[model samples]
Target: MLDRYGFEPAREAPDRVRLRNCPFHPLAAQAPDLVCGMNHAFLTGYLQGLRAPAVQAILAPSPGECCVELQDATEDGEGAAD
Candidate 1:
């Protein structure tokens, strides 16, 4: 799904994954809140649908990077970051 949006994994760790090549660029720059929010929701819903509640999607937009990140849920029960 991320590939469909022109995103590719740039880094991966035991607890995190970072993606690169955001196809939503330029537009994302114009409306970061909307774009990033949708991106986060898409990934989050995807994971939930796959029954992986322990993983969560976060909005951690950075220059030249994908707007979303997937990370392990905290033991305290906070999943996605704000």
Candidate 2:
């Protein structure tokens, strides 16, 4: 959907994407290919087990992009914002 709408995957991984860049969503790091306006929410919901694999597949066709967002919250605080 996003790619069909002019969205491109980020060249960097989610962990590699810097927060200071003001990304629209943290999951933007994971689904670097899809155009997401709310990656943080997507990641949050996915973590809570609300987002389905079909939804992810519908969003991106690549395996790397499929699991772009981290499911574990433990990796979240490294660059948490104030």
Candidate 3:
């Protein structure tokens, strides 16, 4: 979706992983259960809020890739890493 939006990932320190702009960082704190919840419904809710004008945009799997990657990261035990 970032590519479609003409936005590239912003790199952060330590890890070369791409960073993303999330004005909704506050929601993440509210959804502590998001990453661990069933089917990532909390994240889906958070996304729905991000693309309110075009609800269909949130349905696209391209954006969901980030969530999938997050899942992999957590599964790899990175969730507990310092």
Candidate 4:
């Protein structure tokens, strides 16, 4: 699924997954806020469609990667560190 969008799993921990690619690259470069928000929405919906309620997608933009990240919120879900 992520592969189709040019997303590569840069890192994966027990409670988080980091993406190394942004599908909307050139566009995102032009408009970070807009494209990043859409990316977040799409990932959120994707998780919901998969019936994965424990995982949540949020805007955690960083260099050389997608703006949205998947964090396993099973334990408190908020700012808890891995």
Query: Rank by TM-score, descending?
Result: 4, 1, 3, 2
User: Candidate 2 lDDT, tens digit per residue, 1-82?
Assistant: 2344223434345433212232334565655545343554554454347543222211222333333333223344432221
Top model number, lDDT: 4
TM-score of each: 0.80, 0.23, 0.25, 0.85
| Candidate 4: count of backbone clashes, pairs at least 3 residues apart or interchain | 0
Task: List candidate 3 segments past 4 Å from native.
Answer: 3-8, 12-15, 35-82
Q: Residue 32: error of model 1 in Å?
A: 1.1
In model 3, state the lDDT of residue 11. Answer: 39
TM value for model 3 = 0.25
By TM-score, the best candidate is 4
lDDT of 4 at 31: 96
Query: lDDT of candidate 4?
Result: 0.82
Deviation (Å) of 69 in candidate 1: 0.3
lDDT of 1 by residue, 2-80 (tens): 6666878655788888878677888888998888887888888898888887788887878888789888878347854
TM match of model 1 to true structure:
0.80
When 2 and 3 are scored with lDDT, the better candidate is: 2
Residues 1-82 of candidate 4: C-alpha lDDT, one tens digit per residue: 8877787865578878888899888998999999999999999889889888788887889987899888876655353232
